[model samples]
Target: MLKRVIQQFQLDVLATSEVEDSHSSTVYKCTLSNGENVYLKIPFTKLKYQRELEAYEILKGKVSIPEMINYWSGDEECPGAFLLSELKGKPLTSAAKPTTAFQVGVLHAKMHSTQPPSEQVLNGMKNEFPNWSHFIDQQFYSFAEDAKYILDERLYQKAIEKFERMKQQLPLSDGPSFIHMDFRPANIIVDNEQVSGVIDFESVRFGSTEVDFSKLYRDFLSYDSSLYSAYQRGYNSIRPLIDLEKVLPFYRFTDAFNSIGWCKRRGNQEHALFLEENLARLKKWLL
Candidate 1:
């Protein structure tokens, strides 16, 4: 079906291979007749496809994100997907140097610096929530409800109590900057030790930079102190990150719980248990 769609589109597909095969979507790298490379994102659900499209539209010019070559919606026989010009370089991996984290930090700050029309477009999504805090509050309760059986009740309750207290002490910021929302090394492509492009913006929206940074810290920085400090140096150089004391901790805890809930949902027992065993490790960040 995908092949037919490509042929019908008059694309001279020189060669094609699966680049990323994930639950949500399967991205194919296509080498066109003209020798130009592009990626096609075919999501499992319509919602993910739509999310990807919206993200590209809202963010194409805001930062060093991929450019949309075409947003294709096929007829009844065919399907819909996005064709994006290939981003330069490879994914940042475990082999990356600490300096790569700093480069990512700099790019993140630059992305956050994007204001106005771009932020408006991104943040304007899902207006059902009053604000960022409201959106997070709703998610937190939802996470607790979903993980109640999977996690220890007392530990979960303690987490809620701590979070509620922190919420009261934390000051909420007005208006959001465009945040990648899923900022991390794997989503970042680096070339010559510099950030070339950022992918996986399906979760992109108008939100706090703190939440974005928290995911990075939770994923890699917690283990590598050098990476953490370098990232801080890179980020702080562009713009001072806000809400570090009260708000950042909330995001850190949220990332852990969210990961656990998602892993359990996917029946990924190994990862879920890994998250559970290391749950206590997130406490330092919580306080």
Candidate 2:
């Protein structure tokens, strides 16, 4: 299908074509006749296509985000939708040193500062689950159920109880902001010690700033306390730190559950270790 699209579009050279990630998408790296490198991302679902397109449109020119060169809808010829863009630099893991947590902290802080046009912001908000609790209870809960065997059910239940209590104690703040809901090391591309590009905006949504921060810290920074401190320092440089005392437990709970889901879905053995480790960590923090 992609080969046919390349021929139809007059693409001269193809560099790479393969399944990119867990999502239902095929990514192709192609070199055009004009010698420009381009990337094509094909999505299996119409909802995914529309969401990704909307995110690309909103994020274009705002930061080092990919520029959409063209978009093709599903038709008799192509059963799925595809979007083409200039191929960005290599993934951070490939070309550069792992970004320091402080660097990610600064990047996220800057991202949160970004405000989209009023209508776009409103539309994004409408698409997101109303609150963090609902998102966790619905999305995270269902995912957790699949990996229940790997988790310590007693600890998990306690964490859930703690999460509910913390949710009630959440402090008031300025409402929602545009969030890269899945911001993590894997989704970023770095070159020359700087973030060259951000990819996979599928989880992009309007949500609490902390929710985005939780994803980054849990996935990466939590591995190193030094990194966590560095991230906090970088983030505090942009915006004042919120009183996270109330929400920390809930965030940790969400992180453990979400990681379990990822591991189970991917058939990852290390995920079991991660669950046990995070469960212990959460217990210590909560106690």
lDDT (tens digit, per residue) of candidate 2 on 1-287: 78766755566773655635435466777766677777777666665666677777776766567777667766665644454665345554422333455566666777676654576543322334355557656766776676575657786676567766766766664336667777866676665676666777656666566666665665666677676777788778877656555566566666765666666775666455755666566667555
Best by TM-score: 1
State the local distance difference test value for candidate 1: 0.69
lDDT, candidate 1, 1-287, per-residue tens: 66865765568889998875244567788899899998877766555566677767766666677888777765564346777887788887656677888878788887787653524453324432247678778777876776666667777777788768777766766336667677776788888777787887666566666567776766667777788778878888888867565566777777777666666666666465656644655444444
**What TM-score do all the candidates reach, one by one?**
0.81, 0.75
Q: What TM-score number comes out for model 2?
A: 0.75
Model 2 CA RMSD to the hidden true structure, in angstroms: 4.2
What is the lDDT, from 0 to 100, of the residue 83 in candidate 1?
Answer: 77
